[model samples]
Target chain A: MKILSTLILLVALALGSAQAQKFITKSGNIRFFSSTPIEDILAHNRQVNSALDQQTGDFVFRVLMKSFQFEKALMQEHFNENYVESDKFPNATFTGKVTNIKDIDFAKNGVYNAIVEGDLTIKGVTKKISEKGTFEVKDGKVIGKSTFNVLVEDYGIKIPGAVAKNIAKSIQIDVDVNLEKLE
Target chain B: MKKKWLIIIGGLAAAGIVLALLVYFFVYNKPHKDYSKAKPDFEVEAIAFFEEFRTNAAASSARYNGKVIAITGQLSSVEVTDEQVVALFEIDEGMFGSEGVRCVLIPEKAETLISIPPGSTITIKGHCTGYNETDVILEHCSIAI
Candidate 1:
């Protein structure tokens, strides 16, 4: 009987804490880098928006592909037309949750590393990924950051061998995000 | 000996001239459009604008061509290309509501983007060139500092 009462109290507290975390950020960053011996390409998209459900550890991030710019006009054309098919797949996304919710204390200040497992979708392909990311809580604001790699082929991005050797099979991705506490 | 020295100097000068010309062609002669100068037609919050644009990219692509529009948001991505400069400005944490749309600015307008750090607010002006899903295309855009 005592254990049941304690469980009820814990569930109530969790629900209350989640209700308190209604904040989100309108802008975030997602970057991709593909380096090959023949050419090294780096592209990033800054205009990302995401929301974090503190109670459920649910998050969603998005960006447009056409927004990615390259230095050479030829390269930009190729990126949109050939590589990313910007016209076909205009947006990329990440939807997931933080596994260890009990470890995060949003009211406190300091940096804590959390493992966030989520599904990242790009170019019409989705993959399950677990990322080790940094989370910071300061003055009611939370910031999250992580870096990982994804294979182009996994998403069905095909590169001809002529330049394929130059482009690594897997691309490195970096993410930096910040969110404000909502009332 | 004096004649030979003069000839050598002449050759060196000619080589220097050729090198300078080559550098100019390779470095500075190409297209240098910086679209960050096109005036903005409107100013809208990033999230709300993205939602509206994404809802109608397929229908509006033709109408948006070469149209200038203004957007404010965090700088999400920057890509420098020889044919054109492109930047992706985004805002949204969810796929719904006001968080899915982005402004893709190209060409000369990119020049005004002096520096964009992650998590900073920026307002940009450029022409709309239709839509690819959630991206609102802008041509000849410039930043409104």
Candidate 2:
């Protein structure tokens, strides 16, 4: 009976440690900027959902396209109605892995550079992407941040000739998320 | 006679320019919708609303996305910050995490939000941003009195 109890305690400890390997944030922030000579457009979405698995190096982000708020209502309308078509494709997701997760020590309080490779889906189109970001481990929280440029045309978003000058061909995307331990 | 015609044309040109400026200001520089004052398109209980999404996400999203909705439920949790207050309504426990209606309240309601204890029933009105496979996001939320 003693040996059996010891085995059960060990199994419970293993499960507890496994749970500690996951971190998540439901209120992540994602911003996209499009700059042109005629106009500059920027939108922010604070309802991003992201998760990271320390053991597997798996990272995932889910962004609701409709949650993006723009300064100009017209821009937001056009972005949803004509650009990304939020009615048809309401969410954009990134499912990838941190290639260099081994180098980052989550137990230590410091910022570490990370490379993530994953499939990014936008407007129902999936594209493979590799981006560089930083993970800051502080106060038992992990803050992940990254900025990258995505070509508008790559996602099959066609700009009309009339408003082409108002929008940029490539948009700069910024991601910031503070993830807490699941337990 | 020619001078008179030119004056009329000039006056019309000036009026046209003024009209163009008005259109630009009203259409292009229009402000975002103030959800605090706007009436919700749908008033639903939090559990029913979440179940609709879980049962048929595509149809629920079509009906609710980008629309202002009022949801009443027991507050499961609250995360307060200087910028905003986020309140969660317990929906279900998924493999990844707990799924629910997550409302991001306007910064002005931070004080009121913090005072409310968890498990208290409340109604939140905001713009629904559809389900992210886990939580149905609501932004610019206000406590519906």
Candidate 3:
């Protein structure tokens, strides 16, 4: 009877872990592009932290603003100090749920169209957004990619009038995350 | 006499423009830190560093974020991504199983990666990216031999 009790306890613990199906990626990629008559600006941040819950269809992504690197050191410095104000607002985060979670099979090896609705916080302002994304499940990994455009004025990021010609009113952002099942 | 004054003013304006261009190209546009030779601002054991961040994330970030730090600890794991190499130092495993400090190395200059094995003590220098979940991250790391 004692041995039977121990077996039951072990199985219960195993089932508890299996129920928490979470996939996470630490080194995700985020890039932003802006085009103007004068110059085109581009920046990338590789140390993006993100996660997806398989059971709940919940998603979250967080990135440090200062981690973004640009080709020109001056541009990077201006982006942090003047534009994003990294000292006051250090990180940008997104938290939302996938609406079509039930339509896609987690165990299948194929690409599925997904819609994510969430709140994106940048420069201390939070805005609700929904965007189309691609979810690919293959070889024990989940890959996600999406592209969207955001207006700088909505987030209260102002481009000074003196150099306004060097920047665009809207910026295009690209996100790619390759997640592995949490073990 | 008027022509002489005009020539002097033109010459001074030209010199000012040249000076401004030189400063823009040489001073403001240069790289900020020479990480290959810059000394670490703070040196501490890996376990203590991780503990501080885990205990209080906000205070720890204010003290260490964006700063170059040196940490000594046992190598836990080495991961090579497509763009860079990341080394995790084992501070302590949680009741469940979570790691501690994670340092990402410069792919080009990570020459000392071959010598250190898992569980061997080593020192590394890098820019701290603050704490996230079970990790205290650093980027552009260089191992100290």
Candidate 4:
């Protein structure tokens, strides 16, 4: 009888906490860099839309392809027309969950290792990926950041043979976002 | 023979001048169209702009994507950082829910944006990157004249 009442109390507390566990960030930063022999090409998309369900560890990130700004206008034009083809593929997304949810405490402030496994889609192609990331709670806000690499060919992005030397096969990706509690 | 040689040299000089002029006009002195100085393609209300996308994303993107647009809307939030100033506008529920129209303003012109409070009406001009699933994002934004 005593164990049954304790279990019920724990369930009630979890339910209460779940209601306030959603976090959102409208301006997250997602950047990618490619370093090749001919040139080092990189772009930063500061308009990433992301949401996190803290109770369930569910995460989703979306960003417009045209939002990735380049230093050179010609490169930006080529990237839109030839490379990622922003007109055809408007956004890239990742929908997944933090796999190591049990180790992190939401109510407290700390840096915890998080492993995220999800479907990452780019250029209308989706791939299953698992990567290690970090979750840091500071000043009552959750900050999530991660770094990974993806090959251009992996996402069905074609690089022409002539300029292939200018682009690296693998591109490094970086993400940073400060999440606000969803009201 | 000497007269013919002089005429040939003179002709070569004239062709060189023309080539240089062409390079100056077409290559070196070409105009640079900055978004700050360029005219906006469209001026729209935030609600109406988002409504078009919500109704027909394909048509809206075809018309508005990759163009310089000016949008008027209420500021939902503002974020200032060392690098840039970001302004966010709400547009009801989007593909999933909770739609937003976000504008990233010019760093040099961020001073004019300080006085505007959240929920105040403002017009911003920028390059419309296009609508993602949840947000319509603009880059190189500035306070509209």
TM-score of chain B of each: 0.53, 0.95, 0.88, 0.76
User: For residues A59-159, could you state the per-residue lDDT of candidate 4 as single tens digits?
Assistant: 99988888887776677777889988888888889999998887888789999899999999988999999999998988678899999999889999899
Cα lDDT listed for each candidate: 0.67, 0.93, 0.84, 0.84
lDDT of 3 by residue, A8-27 (tens): 99999978766457888888
What are the per-residue Cα lDDT tens digits for candidate 2 across B1-145?
9999999999999999999999988998888899999989999999999999999999999999999999999999997754568989978998567898999988888678878999999999999999999989899999985
* TM-score for each model: 0.62, 0.95, 0.90, 0.83
- Name the regions of candidate 2 deviating beyond 4 angstroms: A1-7
**Consecutive 10-residue window with the lowest summed lDDT within model 4 chain B:** B24-33
Model 4 alpha-carbon drift over 4 Å, by segment? A1-16, B1-33, B81-83, B93-98, B117-120
Name the runs in model 1 displaced over 4 angstroms.
Answer: A1-20, B1-33, B37-58, B61-124, B127-145
Q: Between 2 and 3, whose DockQ is larger? A: 2
Candidate 3 structure quality by residue, lDDT tens digits, B1-145: 9999999999999999999999978865688565647899899899899999889887888898878999998888787788667888866665224568878888765657755787888888988867765678887888875
Per-residue lDDT over A82-150 for candidate 2, one digit per residue giving the tens place of the 0 to 100 score: 999999999999999999999999999999999999999999999999999999999889999999999
Docking class of 4: acceptable
Clashing pairs in model 4, backbone N/Cα/C closer than 3 A: none
For every prediction, compared with the true complex, DockQ reads 0.09, 0.81, 0.43, 0.38
- Given candidate 3, what's the lDDT at residue B15? 100
